[model samples]
Target: MSKSNFIKVIVAGFLITSIVGCGTKNFKKTPLDNYIVENSNEKQFSVILEDMDVDGTFFKTYSHKYRVIKHKEDDTPYEQISDWIEVDKKFFAKHEDNLGMVILEKKGQGKISKVASPPGYGYVGDSRYGEWRTHNGSTFWGFYGRYMFMNQMFGMINRPIYRNDYDTYRGGGYYGSRNYYGPKKGGSSRYGTNSQQTRKEKPNFFRRRASKSGWSSSRSRSGSRSRSTGFGK
Candidate 1:
């Protein structure tokens, strides 16, 4: 083959490979849109917490009890589990409005405690704030005496329904993940001996800085744990 032709073929191959394989950093799951139709009125969705007991000796998995139901219709939709995964304390400080709604957050190893409420009583005005209250005003999730382990499930219709605000608003929150990634429609702290309210109200150790359309990293350190309590409760 001619040298020019070989170079052109190689460039084309590289472009194709990049286009097909490139994916988001720190994430391994697919987008929710692929499974669920954004605004489909056909199916109903719900999320339940799988109760688990870790006796420090061995960990046994339990079925999820409460569920955050999205749609109540008979038909069931498909959605990504991660789309519903949320990290509470970390999420609220960055996106306060997201409170009372289900959302997802990313955390490093041992940082699973990322899901916690803002101290005592969970919510200030509404007890339902930190706890998961069903659409029917019933206890759904949250309120684990020890460590709470649960999963958020997303649902959508199979029809080719038009996408909604979530799908369009792609990473619109503190986590910089897809806006629809969490509760779409709706949308931590160090430990200490201080009071729950006082501690939760305190500022987070890591502060987000201005971005310049590029990549960056952040780091912070603190001594205590359990300063705030939500999904981790």
Candidate 2:
């Protein structure tokens, strides 16, 4: 190969590499998001935005919970569990409105989606976990006999998963970097904090801390729910 051609090739490669690197740097995941990606070993896992306290730019921290519903590769749905973590301002801006919703979910390590999803939406339509059924011409999602307990765990007894809505969530860019609430109607979604069916799930530390005045979130921390009368009480 000629020296001029080789030089041109190297220059082209360098520019491409630099461009790709810059793009990667633009998409920064919060520590909570990173935790789900690095830790979950099940076939599917997700993170929920439970609550937050933002007192100006100086002290802003959001609390979150995560659960891996599946056990290994099996169809059995594990008992849903969640743990809380604090996030910075950047994470706050990205997921505040979607509080009490799944801000991130992973399917077999393929994609760690940031698009806000409804609670239990991660496992609702997956064929391995549940299936579609029709009742008087209206179709809805129902888990198998063994997984029936999840129906209450996810608060879906009154609100059934309709086929049309489920397909939209799984198919296209329904919300695109925004939280997705089912149905176009004015009413709030069933899972997010905005709805009456579901309440903000927070750990005791923040719950007790919530009542105190002037809180700041300069760093991140994780905690579990406490039996004591905390935030909700």
| Best prediction by lDDT | 2
The C-alpha stretches of model 1 lying farther than 4 A from their native spots are: 1-3, 19-25, 30-42, 46-66, 70-99, 102-233
TM-scores of the models, in the order given: 0.25, 0.64
Q: Give a tens-digit lDDT track for model 1, residues 1-233.
A: 99999999999999888777775442332122211333234333322222111111122111111223332243222232222232222222333322222232212211211232212111112232234434444333342332221222211111111223223332333223322222212112111112232223323311211221110110111111112111221
Model 2 lDDT per residue over 1-233, tens place:
99999999999999999999999976755655455655556456665555555433333445544543445445565544455455444555555456557676776545667787776777775776679999999888998887888786665786677888878776757433556777644476655545644444435534655665644332343322222111110
Estimate every model's Cα lDDT from 0 to 1: 0.26, 0.60
Residue pairs in clash, model 2: none
TM-score of 2: 0.64
lDDT of 1 at 228: 18
Per-residue error for 188 in candidate 2, Å, reads 3.1
